[model samples]
Structure formats: structure tokens, C-alpha cells
Target chain A: MTSLTLNAIVSQMAAIEQFTNNILKILEQDARTTPAQIAVMTGRTEQEVKDQIAALEQKGIIKRYKTVIDWAKAGRERTYAFIDVKVTPSRGVGFDDVAERIYKYPEVQSVYLVSGEYDLRVVVAGTSLKEVSFFVSEKLATIDNVQATITHFVLKRYKEDFEIFEDTSEDRRLSVAP
Target chain B: MKPISHIAKTVPASGIRKFFDIVSQMDDVISLGVGEPDFVTPWRIREACIYSLEKGYTNYTSNYGLLELRKHISTYLNERWGLHYNPENQILVTVGVSEGLDLAMRAILNPGEEVLIPEPSYVSYKPCVLFAGGVPVPLGTTPESGFKVTPEQIAAAVTPRTKALLISYPSNPTGATISREELQAIVDVAREHDLFIISDEIYDRLTYEGHHTAVPELNGAYERTILLNGFSKAYAMTGWRIAYAASTPDVIEAMMKIHQYTMLCAPIMSQMAAIEAIKNCGRECDEMAEEYNRRRRLIVAGLNNIGLDCTIPGGAFYAFPSIKKTGLTSEEFSERLLFEEKVAVVPGNAFGECGEGYIRCSYATGIDQIKIALERMERFVENLGVEGRLKAAGRE
Candidate 1:
């Protein structure tokens, strides 16, 4: 009997989910940070950082280079939300087929499959919760495979991977409990 | 990426949203697609909001909302609309008519419950119903029965799991309202089935024919009905986001718990403005309604003149006309009219399946703009070249 090592099983799973988001963990961050700096942070070779980015790019995972705007400065300073959705596939269709149909909606910034009663989740932005609910129901729930949905509005986001690029170097104080 | 959550993955996109996005991209589009008041917030209401801000009253109130706002809502409903509610216990001020609809469903629905939703309704009802973990079983209505929810249709749609029957009069998309007599029949069916009623009366004050009746005021309904009304339509305060739900304490209490966890309360200023709206500006609200009625007549009469026979609406600011004679789908005709004629009316299908071969044209605009829209629509009709284009002329 052949035995698969733990690392081998993990690598196999990671390979499939690699498209979910590249594990560009510990990417160069310091404005003074570069491929050379990341190499120093992770104790990898300077050339290795460049090679990993190139590999990720070749695999079509690194889609584009983008800039982050401060949300307050961007005139979108209001509360942001994420709506968790569950769709009933139209016409006896399965989740994949129905999701494929709905994810194509313009208001949907992101889409995912979730655990529990609902099979899918969506991220959307709107001026207000009423606007968000309007989008989910009037827009998303009307689609096939959206049998039902439960929306968990973000109360406050303590962590956001793409934004809040602070390293916790400063003494951060909160008057109210986060 | 495992995507984000269950909700993001499952629900489909909204048709109205998709249409708005498309329309937003087009040049020279005059959209009657949006179902909101065109008038700005009345001066008295705006002054009231300013007064609240000047007084520096800008903190979150009780989860149910400011006590005075609720008291005003309670009194306003009773004094004007003939409905009764307890300020402290039976009312939950909400984000808008939109949130009140959601709160009603959230409070009522158990998982897998079915909501008997009437078709050609305001776009939000079905989705709001579904979001509360209820299934929306759409009961189709038509011009034949004045587009009101027929008692027979309600009986056919109800099942054991049917938790609520949603009733929206002076309905959006369809522009229909039920008579007091007609409502009594449906009320009988709802009582027999032990079903709850979620009556939406946002357009209650805009009626052209007669005064709107409050179902909750009817015999035995005050206990079961969750009546949702708002100042948006009446006061032209779309952005104010103040609406309230009047119901039994159990329902309002359940809604308040959810409202506290979620919304907290409606904007402090909006509630304050609403207090003045109910207290001071009754005539100002009616002036906007009267203007809409004028444009309603202009559009409906013009459409009839040009061969689109419409069910002249009794309340609300819309005219629903049949487009069958045009030989184009509601989507196609509206799209063509947008580009070629520079007029935008929402497709009937934007409302529901039964909304096919019809269109909802809001008269929420000036008479001059209504005139321009009508003339351009007449040209579009003449050019459709459908065999029955002239058939509509006879129906008029």
C-alpha cells in the first residue's frame, strides 16, 4: 500500500485552491521594501522573490498591479458591508450552474461558496444597507439557485487583508472595545 | 478564494439593478425606471432636519427609535390613516419603507416558510421576503380584476407553510389598489388560513379616487397585520430614510431586537424631520400628490390618445399600459424608446412574470416632461409597425 505524506496531501489541496488567491504571504510591504527587502524579511534569496512573483504571474494568479486609495479620501467613507447569499438554482440546475449565472451580475464585487444552509456568498458595496439589501434581493436573489439568503452585515472590520496596510508599530488605542 | 460567505455565492442578481446599470451607461436616457419620489424633500421637512442638527441631537436613540418620533408616527397613523399603534411597544422606526419590509419578514419568517407575495409589486418585496428565510410564492394579478389581489388567487397560493401574505396597494409596477370591499374578501381568506398580513401602504395617501382604508383597522386584523408606511412618498423625502412598522407588540419587539443588532435606528435627523412632517406639513405633502396626479392624467390620457390603453391608476404616481399592440417585448420596446425616442419606461417584466406586455411609467415628473415623453412614445408606437398598433386605438 502506498502512503501519502501530510505535506503531499496539503500540497495537493493547495495546488487546486492556488487560484483562490496566491499565497503571496509576506510580499514586500515597506515603501522602502522591495524584492530585496522581502528576501531579507523571509531570509530568502533576492532572486527568489522575483522568481516567485514571475511564477505566480505565469499561472494567471497575479492578475494586475493596482493602487489602494484611502477610502475616506475616496468619497466612499461611509460604512462598508458584505452580504452572505444563498441562491436556489433555477430550473433544476445545481449550484455550479446557477452560481455561474449569478456571479456574472455587475453589482457583485466578489462571489464565494459558503458553508451551512446556503451554498454561495457574495460581497457587494452600496451607499446604505437599504441599498445593499436592494441589490441582494432585487438583483441577486432574483437569479436562479438563490433559494434563500442570510445577510450578516459587517459591524466593524478589525482586519481587512488588502486594506489597513499598517504593521501595528504605533500604539493603537481604542476608546471603545473593538 | 472560498469566495466570502454563503450569501454571496447563492443569490442571483436583480433584474432592476441590471437594467439600471445598462441604462446608466446610455446617453440621452430619461429613466422612469426608478420607483422613488421625484420631488425634493418638502421645505418644512428640510427645515425640521436642520433644526434637529442645530440642536446637536446626533446620537443613536433607543433601538426602537426616538420615543417622540414613534409617538408622532402613532398619532399620524391614527389621526390621518385611521390605524392605531402603541408608540413604545408597537412601532419600530426603520431605515425606510425598504427596511420596514425586511423587518416584517425577519420577525415573521421561520426557515422554509412560504410568503404569498403578490406580483407586479414594488421590486423589493420578493427579495426582502426571501432574505428573511422565506420562500416567495408570487401570485399573479392582471388588469381584468383591477390588478388587486383576488381572494381566489390568495387561496390557491396559500399552503401550510405559508407564513405571511404581503399586500401592497397603490402597487408599484402595476399601479393597482384594492377597494375596501375587495380587501374584506381577501381578509376573510387570510383569517381563515390563520395567516399573517404584511400590508404595505407607502402610497396610501396618494389616491386619486378616494381615501385609502387601513386593513389593520378592520375587524380582527389589528392583531395580525404588520402595517408598513413611510413619509418618503407623501413628503417626497426619499433620501430621508424614515419609515415605521405598526404591529402587535410581539412582532414589533422581535423586529426591534433585529433592528437593534443591525440598523440601531434610522438617521436621527430623518426621524426629527418626520416628527415635523407629521405634525406640520400635511398640505405640502398633498400638493406634491396633486402635481403627480396631474402628470398621471397627462401621461395616461396621452398614451390612450396614441393607442396604448392603460389602467388609469387611482393612487400612486404611475400608469401601467399594455404594450401588446406594439409587437415588441416590454424590454425591447423600452430599449428602443430610450435610444430612438429618448424616453425611458421600465419594462413590466422588471416587476414580475405577469408584468410582461406592459410597462410602468411614473408620472413623477413635470407636465412638460410628461408631454415630451408622451409625444416621443407616440412616435415609437407609430414606428413599431405591429399589425395591432391601431388595435390599441380602438381600445382607447
Candidate 2:
């Protein structure tokens, strides 16, 4: 009876692992996979799937759901640039303070501490190239760490967030063929 | 003044079509009925086709397909399954497995020969066999056996007229796959009976529980096997409609004969895309299979929890859940589920008669939609006294 109880516990743990792996994979591919849908796909009750998702969210495993938009295809015009920074570390904070200050800017989309010629890599987006240029010179270069900045303007985006930018091909499948 | 062929008239319209017709009339229906993958073709494969088109590869390919593409396919098959076919004469590129099946049927079948088909499979096998003038002998498999066609079953069903056995593993509707050992047993029977084997391995890459064994890989089965596979399910290239059949020289020549006049070639652009898919998109296929595996686990568990006992399907995206507890036939259950809960699932009988008391729910949709459909189905099942039946069976 004791061995049976232990085996039951082991099986229960395995089931939970299965649920976590399945839920994470679905959410990773398309966060729009609803808790209800996740339930159906996972063969768990909606409540269970929902609870697991909520737990994952609380545990920070699921940061957020995002939509991948082809801005070029959508006819939305935007300017983007990658700005590399050479920042001098503060006495105590190193690059942490400067990185935080740069990331706090609304124009800044992403910031990464790097290991190359530049100390920090910043991705910024704006309405136009002029605006992005202005942001880099006026706001980013003006930060207190106060080092040189090199900005590389993006001419074209071949792919972004796992979606190809240009996909104009029509469906070639026959309507009734198996 | 009408001239529809007798064979065309004899073949019944697919049950899937009827179910979809009803689904189309309804609004906001959460459908688990589509057989294709939810993922679009991987971008690199699509891009390869675009590249090919830009490079002026618009003309038709060789009747046997591009030698380069066939070489890559040969390499892929060899590396993945240890099965080798000479690309020059043993491979025939096709317009998806649909045309491949048709070609295989037409290539081998005499006017009155029969093809033994295991039931609860993809919808095209029976019709393709019939259209080729071969009688389709349905070999029924039961849920208790994981929907596997046992050697005993095949042995019993075989007749002198049975010239070939058509099988799809990691099956479409049932998601049932016979183990390698079990398949060897069946292959042994096929060998003893001197039957040809037409193996549809379109879903080979999608198995979750175990590796899929290509029938031709089994000893003594290669010469008699027509192994059909494609880019559709594996690479989410269904729309591309490029597939191939690998068999012995004589069988391939026979298939190519039908293919040359009828198809000329698989679309050159799609064939180019298939080359890229076969060569570069393996990781993406594995990732997609992993995603499907998760959904498979979820749907199988969800259905069984609701008293609609479902065996954990090892492959494909479908969950064949028995609706026996509700005392409703498969069609009746599908109709009511669509009408009342707005959740669309294909009736199992859409595959064959052995699927009568079951329904095939696809988990290829968004996870949220699957959950909503399951809830709606659970409610629908409870209203039909499924809970009471579960208690009576002492299964809860």
C-alpha cells in the first residue's frame, strides 16, 4: 500500500511535468492559444489548464504575449536603428545605471549589455530616420556615462520575430484534393 | 447528355465535406476538424521557392522530377530511416500524397484486383483505390487494439483477389501507429500472402511516443512496398502539393507512366521548395511535432476526463475519442456538438465504419480554442448523461 501511494505520487509529478511542457510550447509558438484551448489541446480541464497558465505567469516563466506584425506589409512606416554605445562605468554601479537610464527612454525598444568594441547595444525606433538620428545624438549620447555612440540605420527587414517580411505567395492547394 | 462515369457516381462524397458544410453555416464555431497543420510552411522553404522563381525556374521539371531534388530526398530517406532508393529510377515526384496514392493504385491494380485498406484512415485511400478500378476491402480495426490492424485481422481478411495492402501509420483520424514489431508481424503475413504494400508515411515525422518505422525498412518488405511521403504535414507545406513515392524500378516506372501524362511534373516551384524543406527544415519539423505532442497529450487527457475514452494517439494531430457513453452515433454526436456547442469535430465514420462510435477532434487549432471546445464538449456530454454512465462504469 505504501509503495502504491509512492507510485501514485510519482505518476502525478510526471503528469504535471507533461502539462507544463505542453502549455509552454503552445504559448511560446502563439501566446493567443487561450487557456480554454490549451485545456482542450492538453486534455486537461479548462480550470486546470487555466490554473497552470496562471501559475506559469506568476512564476515568470511566461513574461508576456506579443503580436508579430509585418509593419512594412501593413503599410505602417517606421524608422529603426541599432545604436552601439561605449559607456564609461560609474565608480560603484558599472554599466547597470547607464543601461537602466537608456532603457527607460520611450524610443529605446531594446538594450543589451555586450562583450565587444561597444559596452552596450541599443535598438531604437521612431517615426523617421531624422527623428531616430536626433534621439541618438540628443538623448542617448547625452547620457551621464557620456561616451561615443555609433548608430546603424536599418535599410530593410528580411525577417523579424520568426516571420518573414515578404510572403505574397497564394495558397496552391487544390480545394478538394486529399 | 450527361456523361459522369459510373465509378465517379459510386464513390460517396466525403463525410468530412458534409461536416464542414454544416460548420460553415454556423458562426464562431471552434473547429477541430481540419486535417492540415496550423503552422504555415516554414519561411526558408517558402523563400527557396521564391528564389527559384526569381532565378527563372518556371518551366516544368523532368518527368521523374529534378535529379538534385530526388537525390536530396534519397539522402534524407537514407539518413532518417536507413531506406535507400536510387533517385534515377526509383523515385517519382508527385502532386502531394493524393496523386501518389492514385498513381500507386493505377500502376499496380488490374481491373478486378482488391486493395486491403485498414479502416479509420485518411479519406482518400478508398476513393483512390476505387477510382483506379480496384475494389477497396475495408479491414476493420478496433479501439481496444489501439486501432492497429493486427496480423490475425489481415490474415483473416486476405483473399486471392487481394493484391495490395494500403496502410497509413501515425494515421490521420485515429492517430494510431502500429509498433515496429507489430508491423513486422503484419509484413510477415503480407509476405506469406504475396501482397504488395502501399505505405502512406505522410505523418512519419510527427510521432511523439516512438520512432516511425518506414514499412520498406522492414526485412523482405522493400521490394513489394510503395513508400509515399511528402512535405505537407512535416514541413507544413500542404499548399505546395509536392510529394514522392519510392519503390522498386518496375513499380516506379509504372507510377511514372501515369504521372508523366497526367501530372507532367509536380509544380517546379513547389519541387524546389521541397528540396529546401527536405534539406534544411528538419529542426522546424521537429519543433512543430513537439508542439503537436503537447496538444496531443492535452486533448487525449481532456476527452478521457470527460468520459469520452480516448487512447493517447502517438502521432498526427487528431484525437479519436469514443462517444459510446452518450449512446449517440458518431455522426449524431458530431452534429449535436457543432449545433449546440459550436465546436466542430469530424465524425469518426468519416474515415470508415469501424469509427462509428467515435469522433475525430483535431488539436491543430489554437490552444485557447481547443480548451473552449473541450469545455463546450464537456457540457454537451454531461447533458447527455455521460457523468451517470461514467459512474455506472466505475471509471470516475
- Tens digit of per-residue lDDT, candidate 2, span B271-290: 99998998888889987887
Give the number of colliding residue pairs in candidate 2.
13
TM-score of each: 0.67, 0.81
Find the 10 residues in a row with the least total lDDT in model 2 chain A: A169-178
lDDT of 2 by residue, A1-178 (tens): 9999999999999889878988887777778767876776676889998888889999999888888765666787889999999998878768988999899999899999999999999999998989999998889999888589999999988867656677675423221122
Most accurate candidate by lDDT? 2
Q: Which stretches of candidate 1 lie over 4 Å from their true place?
A: A1-178, B4-7, B386-396
lDDT of 1 at B295: 57
Candidate 2 wrong stretches, greater than 4 Å:
A1-110, A113-119, A123-145, A149-178, B386-396
Q: Of all true interface contacts, what fraction is found in model 1?
A: 0.00
TM-score of chain B for predicted candidate 2: 0.96
The whole-model C-alpha lDDT of candidate 1 against the native structure comes to 0.76
Cα error, candidate 2, residue B275 (Å): 0.6
